[model samples]
Target: MIRSLRGRLFLGLTAIIILTGATGGLLVYRWAFREAAELQDSVLIQLASLAQNGSFSSGRPLLGVEEDTDVWLIELGATPRGPADDRQLFGLKDGLQVVMRKGQPIRLLLRTRPDGSRFAVAQPTAVRDDTAREMAFRTLLPISALIPCLMLVTAIVVAHSLRPMVRLAGNLDARRADDLTPLPQAGTPSELHPFIHSINGLLVRVGLLVDQQRRFVADAAHELRTPITALSLQAENLGSVDLPEEARGRVAALKQGMQRTKHLLEQLLALARYEAAPAERGEMPLIALDSAVKQVVADLLPQALDRGIDLGFQLVEPHMVRGEPVMLATMVRNLLDNALRLTPRAGRIDIGIYRQDEAAILQIEDTGPGIASPDLERIFEPFFRGSSPEGDGSGLGLSIVKRVVEGLAGEIALENITGSDRSGLRVTVRLPLAADRPNEVSGAA
Candidate 1:
């Protein structure tokens, strides 16, 4: 029932350790029991020898043997003429014997003295068996103590062996969605090599599929741009021809529709361009982020003026980030364009560029309604305008911004700025700072 591999392996090994220990302990106990019994019998034989050689009377104190057990020294006389117990002892020959006296069992060692007098060394049978069992139990101490240490060692080895797999999973979880890099094989166990190989194969196939999709989108957008432009020109030409008021209105609408279509195609092409990483990424020089935002603002200034919307930088600081010029420019343009579309007349758009830690931060805040609560989670999806889409917005602006930011190995986050009197959306971007070269790059000022 255990779901974790670690639990299963540890338990299986633990069960085997316990089972083997039990079996070995049982065998050891039986052997020790037999050895202990034989050893006690030899003690009786040695005691009998001392009695016959030194000669002792029945009244003598025990020969330094156990005082608690029922041990006895009995003289059967030379003729076996005494009590029934003495008669039974005389009936046996020399050496050791187990016999009954007074209906109780005893271990007896009988030997003949040089003077022809015979005697027996006797101890209770139950007492000798108890001593043997206690000695046997002592033999199992080492094995009982060893089982827990083995289980501890097993747990440590299992965790250490599986650490690499845990680290690999964590690395995959933290990567960007478009990342298709192969898993590393160095330092991994040979047992896991086949699994890693399968995953790397899958990544290669996925990368190829994605590249084909991007190429298809780029080609389709290129093929459509020419016809859309011709249609726009034709509509413009028809506008100047003398026509009724109703026809003029229809012609104007036609031109507007054509313009929206043209913008969509341009946005699609830009997305395709930045969706995959460019080869020039490795050779790109450090460029000034403040200057890139400034250029995009200049290009959009005329449009802002037409709408009476105030657009300007609140703070500009020199910060260098590594990326191509067009990529940065496109990124800034789409962000500003989205802001301009949502901001009403007399509203304000603020841009800031500065350094934070090892990253360059580009932030834009606008005086427009913040995004809907339900849409924030899914706002970056392609063509996912919120519940109330406005103007000629293609909804690809944010999606393109996301792709460009990821391609540059940067992070972007959009949050709603809420206050009692005013509310807006704040877009924050953090790009890794390249080696600073402020003097090498020209300023936009």
Candidate 2:
């Protein structure tokens, strides 16, 4: 319920100080009062002893004594009171303590003279108690007064300590809704620097992704608009056709164009969906890697055979992983399709699935001209197609594979596995093993 951080900090600090001060003050007051009472009693007893030794001789108390010393004299006017009571001597002192009444504490020295006379010197207990109380109050007053000052200083320190958070909040508040600029701060404490740097890095990534989305939408609209308009124009032209052979040929060409346009549109939609989905969905089901790989290989075998390319599976295990089956299938299908599309006639393509420690490994190797090392990294980027003799491609296959791999918390690597007899490319996909599986047969089982 204590929302204001500074307020809470000040209160906590003040509470600690007050408790410590009260405890120390209580201890000092008790010790000082006890010592002062002892000093008073010792003075009273010593004075009484000296008086009894004839130190106070005549009618007066003492020689050269200050006028402040009040010594009471009591002569035995009539000694017929009773048997000498020792208790009476105990209370009687060398000095008068007239102000200290019955039941009131007093410090007094009492002496019984040789002639059955008594003399006493006394001071009230109130004197020592009052002095002790006054000293304690004096010490406590300044500390109590300084509490407010201490609170102010504490508040300032807390504010300075939290200045970075305040600045970050202010920056966020001032930013535009669409602004994804990195937060700017300098001289921030080291403890908070990592948080600030993380935020800045996130902003940079989100900003680039937003920029990419904007460009993708614009380009998609532009790309689809032409084909859509062409289809509409062809539909319109069809109604006005008159000749036989010539008109039929025109119709066929227009139909082909429409099909191409439709295919392009579908690919664009798929790419958009791949990009727009949440980076991580709630949870994925466990899918068998062998089954997924074999399905993909089977679906692409016809295409591979059409080009005289050999395609087969080399699975070491039916590795199971947590993944969206459709997405996993898409990734495998794209990798195989990419290989089959580029591999020359009589080339060999190998697909394998197995568990490797805590990961599921899917490796695809194709006997195609290996990607030049410089272009390997760029091949997975959207709309990137390397120098392959095969004609135009939509360039989204490897990109889709990369996106799906990342979405499933997996990794893929491409390397040249070319040999003396064949030049080829190798792709390795590694997905994190399911949490329920203890030891994967691949390694460290």
Candidate 2's TM-score: 0.47
Highest TM-score model number: 1
Clashing pairs in 2: 93-109, 93-110, 93-120, 94-109, 94-110, 94-119, 94-120, 94-121, 95-120, 95-121
Specify the highest-lDDT model's number: 1
Task: For candidate 1, write residues 1-445 as lDDT tens digits.
Answer: 8999999999999999999999999999999999998998888887777787655567354658777655677777788787887897898998788999878898888888878888888887888888888999899998899999999999999999999898888988988878899999998888889999999999999999999999998999999999999999999999779999999999999999999999999999988877755745557767888888888899899999999999998899988888877878888999999999988899999999888999999999998997998999889999999998888988899988988888788899999989998888899999998887756564333
| Model 2: per-residue Cα lDDT over 107-200, one tens digit each | 5555566786555565556665675566556666676777677777877898889888898898899764446767765777788778989999
Worst 10 residues of 2 by lDDT: 74-83
Model 1 score (lDDT): 0.87
What is the TM-score of each predicted model, taking all chains together?
A: 0.83, 0.47
